[model samples]
Target: MTKGLKPTRLIADSSPVMKVPTAPAHLSRDAKTEWRRVAPILVERCILTIGDLGILESYCSAIGLVREASKHLQTEGLVLENGKRNPAAGIMTTAQTVALRAASELGLTPVARSRSGMSAQADPDDDTDNPLAVR
Candidate 1:
């Protein structure tokens, strides 16, 4: 008489590793994913990509013309309203906005220009001037 051994079946715990909660009452999955991606990038850049030494969270959240102006100054060292450091003005520029967010994250406190033609000079010593600083 021969004894037979039982074979074991491999079991896989086929469960999702991470379970994200359902989106908020209004946000769609795509919108949430988009926000998650862009928000982090914006936040990170604001914190890690500026010429100013420090930034307040309140200022970063400030939107509209004032916020755009503030970001322009903080990031590119350009006066938004006056075109002093800037070559032009009146319309808000996306390039400037992107620059400002980046600068904010980098811990730089930008000086915003006034609408009355008050202009400020750029700090030659600011790290943003050097393209190679981040890399």
Candidate 2:
């Protein structure tokens, strides 16, 4: 919603209790569904906190927009009556981008997942976890 991007710092709670947040009442149906799907995993992994709700909500809302736009594109096709691009297509692209950004910040992406494990500040040179690798 702001003009530019803001930084996100994940404060982890190792061995956190499984207290998944409830979906907000203001979210669309699709957003609520997304929240239900994602909240548990984040909570179970102790990756989410009350402070992260704002971004989580944004992620869910963006995912909702993407899913909604996808339905429109499927039913109406990519072009409109005026031979212009479907607005939902743009919405999907932007929403997908936003969702991807939020997902990464939340450590939901494969690349980001590396940081989600214990010891978020692991040293790259530390191969202690790789017993089979050369020292």
Put down candidate 1 lDDT per residue, 28-53, tens digits, no spaces: 34434533434453334322122221
Q: What stretches of model 1 exceed 4 Å from their correct place?
A: 1-24, 47-124, 127-135
Index of the highest-TM-score prediction: 2
- Model 1 — TM-score against the truth? 0.21
lDDT of every predicted structure (CA atoms): 0.37, 0.81
The weakest ten consecutive residues by lDDT in model 1 span 112-121
Backbone clash tally (model 2): 0
After aligning candidate 1 to the native by TM-score, how far in Å is the CA of 12 from where it should be? 51
